[model samples]
Target: MTKKNVHTVPSKGGSGWDNKVGGEVVSHHHKKETAVEKGRSIARANEAEHVIHDKGGKIQQSNSYGNDPNPPKDQR
Candidate 1:
């Protein structure tokens, strides 16, 4: 989905202390990670697909779609 209407879902991996602090009953939107970090996470996810392709386990790398269209910083 485009950034304008990006969908966010709470993670199932809530912590042990969330309830004690009266944290939101559900987790907040997962802040998107930086490109390098996203790539790493994507790689691990793709690895799962490789397991199904038993003949060869290869995960194509993820491309960095890069920053937001209207980033806060100006071109230097």
Candidate 2:
């Protein structure tokens, strides 16, 4: 009777799924993907393909170092 001890019982009810496209039985429990999750997934997929944008969301100009930094080399 307890959920913890319940086994797969098809006669009354069971934790079974109907293998079908857009099945209500299966989709009911699953939550819809949020915008954040979708974005993260897209970012991950893009990273695998080495696609990324800088802070300006644009590729840095070729060989044009922006705001070049000089860390005072060997200045003791």
**Best-fitting candidate, scored by lDDT:** 1
Cα displacement (angstroms), candidate 2, residue 72, comes to 22
**What would the TM-score be for candidate 1 when compared with the true structure?**
0.20
List runs of model 1 lying over 4 Å from the truth. Answer: 1-33, 48-76
Every model's TM-score: 0.20, 0.20
Q: lDDT of all the models against the reference?
A: 0.26, 0.23
Q: Per-residue lDDT tens digits of candidate 1, residues 3-71?
A: 121112223463111110122321232342332243234334333110111112232232223443444
Q: Tell me the TM-score of model 2.
A: 0.20
Writing each residue's lDDT as its tens digit, candidate 2 over 1-76 gives: 1111101111113332111112112111122223223323433433311122233334322121123244336858
How far is 20's C-alpha from truth in model 2 (Å)? 31
